[model samples]
Target: MTGFEFIAKAFKASYTDIAKRLNMTPSAIADWASGRRPIPKDKLPLVSKLFRIDEEYFKKKELTEVEKIKIEINYLERLSKRDTEQIPDTYTDDEGNQHETYFWYNPHEGELRYKYEELAYEELVLRIKRILTHDFALDMEYQRTRNHFHVVKELTELLDQDDGTVGIMEFEDISKEEAQRRRNLADRVNSISRMLYFLNGGKLHAFGKIDEFDEELFKLLRKFKIIDTKLPKKLKELDDPFDHRL
Candidate 1:
């Protein structure tokens, strides 16, 4: 059963009541129930929490390691398709600088798909982080923006190397070039920053204040379903906890 159906059954509520609570129309809730429309990721947690159900239980399936890898590959395939379809033809500007600009038939749909892919990537990263922390006993610490940028940079570097094997080789022996490539790949994968900003009802600003940074990051974590990813003990001990804040 879909999450909406589960929630409706568990709460013993009418579709109208659930719709009112979710700020959606009854038809929308019924559509989700009937699989006529997919549940938007943002509302999944809210529904789960309201119903007091384990969030993971509402997930489509328990993704295995192999399945996770396959998902990443699928994301790459989608990215390739998007790039091929949306990217503009190369042209030289007045300054003699050649550049390409992507054109999209539906820019909004493109943005939505990009965010969906980013959410998948973030889920994989969290899984990897969990494995590193629990299985390998690494002294891993999650610092949201700080740690995410660091890991993205390192992974990008690994993926860029000519002879480097970022995912193929052992993490310790990954070459500098490979690390760079991996970092770049991760950055691209995480480029849903714009989508997160839009979803949070904020405009993309070149320079953001501290409050904006916090809100943006929280929105990103919520969008990617990574709010539960373990944080550093210090951050975890803060007065304003990160868990479930979104």
Candidate 2:
């Protein structure tokens, strides 16, 4: 599904046009498309934005039945288009094999963008249901500490105290049991927020962008009494346009 050919055809945008938009050479994009090289991390967002899709869409994942049907529908729609370029650019593969690659700038890119978004929402909703109902652990590993949930390889900078015990920021003088509870609360807030941020298929989160998911996010956090968790306050608040009150 990450194949550049599929992307070019599926988006109805030619590899040449995409490469031009990215200021990259056509052969380089072809290499990425052909899997001769893994897509450069630096260019991932650029490509994702150029296509109005999350970079996750370019990663290989098992598609749901509905997503497969979307793919099929897009394919059938492609079959109905008769305005594709008559002559295709010849693409040379890593094996020195030549292939014809057609260019199509149909009226389908906008439709494709929305379709990807719909798929993303479907995936997000499905994951939220599972995480809340069935998969209690969310399947991520963690370590129990007196002052932190201590997820493996994350949140390493827990505030160190004079007595060599970890603390969540300046809560070092709090009773040991209460300190542990606060730290656990902070960990849950951090962990779940991280989980929801990357949305699996939804948003292009992080990288210095305002997380529009916040209003609903923090509201959900209050369920477990994350009232004392230490996180940066948002500069401005967003109204939850949708009823995500849980």
Candidate 3:
């Protein structure tokens, strides 16, 4: 069966239901079914996971006639939903504009700090390292070189906070020293973390050149099949959430 149809039927969800889950409309789902619209790469992972199908199946150029037949049979076994909800809209601010921000509760710090932006997975990791290094340096509780180890621990705690989720950061006007301190701390943390990763015998090539780090990391991840197949299993075995690396 075609990957999309197979998944829809297996979930026992209608096209409408599938659309709602993917933040698409029922007609959009139908377009996918009819091959009228191309499936967006960003959504493919989510669709594969939701439908419990191999991601590679959806990456194929086209389905064979036999595959189409299998898909139809699967669809026949399921019933359509009577109602469906629209997906929520995701928005971004205009250039040079500011927006309201919110933050998760920091029990240890005893404060709620506003977030900056909705950071991607890689960005989130870097930001966590940045925050931890600043916190450590400011407290004078850790040696400069030992910041990485401390960062990993602090990050684990911060991520476990109830409000921890995919989010952004917001900044306010601050002294030059404060901003410089924050940047310096973030840079050190990032450097140390990379060194630690290499020391652990993990492949450092995945990180690519340190200059274009984020894009390189994402590209390396896409080149390897490790993330979709292996990382999830590793994540499940880890007791500490932050111990799982991207």
Off by over 4 Å in 2: 1-3, 61-246
In model 2, the Cα lDDT at residue 133 comes to 60
Supply candidate 1's per-residue lDDT for 211. Answer: 49
The TM-score obtained by model 1 is 0.23
Best of the two (1, 3) by TM-score: 3
Model 3 scores worst on lDDT over the 10 consecutive residues at 110-119
User: For model 2, how many clashes?
Assistant: 0
TM-score list, all predictions: 0.23, 0.29, 0.25
- lDDT string for model 2 (111-144, tens) is 3433453454445445545445643544543322
Model 1: runs farther than 4 Å from truth? 61-246
Give me the candidate number with maximum lDDT: 1
Residue 216, candidate 1: Cα error in Å is 67
TM-score of 2: 0.29
Tens-digit lDDT string for candidate 1 (98-213): 99876754323433343344455555566558654554443445544455566555445433434333333333443486457557756654454443344445433322433445
Comparing 2 and 3 on lDDT, the stronger one: 2
What C-alpha lDDT do the candidate models reach, one value each? 0.53, 0.52, 0.50
